[model samples]
Target: MQELAERAGISGRTLRHYHQIGLLEPDRVGSNGYRYYGADAVSRLQRILLLRETGMPLADIAGVLDATTTPAAETEALTGHLEHLAQERAALDRRIKAVEHTLSMRRQGREPRMDVMLEGFNDRYEEEVVERWGRDAFDASNQWWHGKSVQQQKEWKARADALLARWREILQDGHEMDSAKAQEHAAVHVEWFKEIPGTPTHAGDTAKSVDMIRGLADQYETNPDFHVAFGTQEAARFAASALRLRVRRLEPSSADDLRG
Candidate 1:
């Protein structure tokens, strides 16, 4: 047990807790009553750690592990997760490079260009957009966004800010989730999403459209960015619940696809 714990860089107490929760277990017990984990256990621990790195909850990880019976299935899931991690790393690298470039300019008493200053942020958003949608989707959307003039970009941002403010106004007024007023706002929300180019909504694929909306609704509730966008996590959660209800009405058979 101590060896396994050291190898995994986790405390024995955590190992015991995992055992208690049935998330992991020792392969056998010695005659002296010490628990032992074999190579299989070590391999399983690797999978557990990998899934945890993806921010999956322990319960959900267990479900996924249980469901992934074949080696190919496990490989496929891990491969996708690896791609996401690689993109994240690339974005972080870009940020580091941008900051280094800025610092070098500062030492020479030079001001960075607007685009150069924002390069890291653009890369970060690009990575996220590509991961959530697809490379082609990101390409089209990125082109459309930068295609706009500065004034046009600001105006678009103003409209988006207005939409968020309206959402807050409705929530502050104590409107019930899935109520008539909430549903009306949901329609408005869907239309706002439709305005974005290269999204599933504008792709003319019904299933993907449903999926995109559902994914956004899920993110609004569980993603920290949305929590900040909505002024509070509670508000985001409420909006997500309402959106989920409204979207379900629009597509009755669309199921939840929360990632594990």
Candidate 2:
């Protein structure tokens, strides 16, 4: 157990907790009551760590692991995780470069341009966008955003702010989740995503579009920035629930051909 824990860069106590939660278990127990893990355990731990890095909950990771019964399936999942990590690394590199440029500007007693600031901010999630969709997805969106005139950008922000205000009002009105008015707002919410240049929804990739919408809903529920922007945690949660229901109504498929 100690060896596996060290190999996994986690403490023995964490491994024990994982066992307690049934997220992971040793291959066998020795006669002396010691925990033992084998090569299979190492592989499983690798998968667990990779999925954990992707921000998947332990329960969700367990489900994914359980569903990966064949070697082929496991390989496919691992490949996908690796690609995501690579995208994240690339995005982080861009963010680092942006920060460096900002520092240089400050040293020169010059403020960075608005475009530079937005570039850094947008690049902050470039890798995440790439991982969620692909490089072309990020590139297309980035180009579209950067190509906009200052007036257009202001208009876009105003529109977004207005939409958020409507969401806040809806939550404050205490409308039930299943209300027609709420569903109408939810439909507008989904439509908003379709305007993005690189999203699967924009490309009409139904499966990936639904998946992306569902993921964004999860983020809106749990992300602190989203909570602050949306008025309250409860409001964000309500919005997430509504978005999830809307996405579920989309055609279901495992296909993710929105690589571009």
Candidate 3:
């Protein structure tokens, strides 16, 4: 047992704990009260050590071991783990490159480029958007954006800023629940949304835009930075409601169609 522990670079107590947890049981106990591990025990110990080094929780490791029926199954699981590790390593490399690029730019007294600061950020959001809305949804949005000219991109961004400023002003004025200005701002917002090439449209109606506005409101409630730009929760709610009402008025055909 001592020799095995030394070879495994683990203490006897750890080996004993593994045995207790059914991870590395000893082959047998000698008459003189010594624990003897067989070849199978050594293999199990090696697997346990390897999994631990990979940062898997003990409970998860036990579950994985329990689920493994054949050598092929174990190998498949290991390969999957390796793939995950490779992705993590790739992300780390991107971060490192971003940092190095920024450092180089700073050393040369030049402004750091967007590609430097946004290395891993773009992929994170892309993956999330793709997972939630399918590859076609992302591809359509990407294609639409790629087809736009630089001047058109600037115009779109300016329009978006104008819409956001309108929302902020509506909140700042303490507009009535049923105010004309609030409704007008909402109308403008919906119109701006319609002009966006990749926006999802149903029968050319934006009444379904209510759900998206509500989601943004919910996010604002938790994110202070978002709330600060949009004003208070009450204001955000009012803005969302106004937008929904305006969309309903503009697209009466789809107004009756509730979002699921």
Best-fitting candidate, scored by TM-score: 2
lDDT of 3 by residue, 1-260 (tens): 99999998989899878878777779998999789989987887788898889876677677677786676666766777788788678668657876898899899998664421111114435685466445655555554654568698677666655665677677778886458998777656655544433334422434335544445445545544444445455655666667556555655554543221
In model 1, where do residues sit more than 4 Å from their true spots? 1-133, 252-260
Q: Which model is ahead, 1 or 3, in terms of TM-score?
A: 1
The residue pairs that clash in candidate 3, if any, are: none
Residue pairs clashing, model 2: none
Ranking by lDDT: 2, 1, 3
Tens-digit lDDT track of model 2 for 1-260: 98888978999998888888988888998999778988887888898898788765688678778885776665666677677777677667657867998899899998653331122226667778787778988888776775688799888877766665677788789887667777788878767766778877778788777777787788778877677667678877888887777666544532332222
TM-score of 2: 0.52
Local accuracy by lDDT, each model: 0.71, 0.73, 0.62
Per-model TM against the reference:
0.49, 0.52, 0.48
User: Which 10-residue window in model 3 sums to the lowest lDDT?
Assistant: 115-124
lDDT of 3: 0.62
Model 1: weakest 10-residue lDDT segment is 112-121
Candidate that scores best on lDDT: 2
Clashes of 3: 0
Q: Encode model 1's per-residue lDDT on 1-260: one tens digit a residue.
A: 99989989989998888788888889988899788999988888888988888865688677667776776666676676677778677657657877997898899998643331112124546787677677887777655665678799788777866765666778888998877888888777777766666776656555776777777788777867666667777777877888788777877542332110
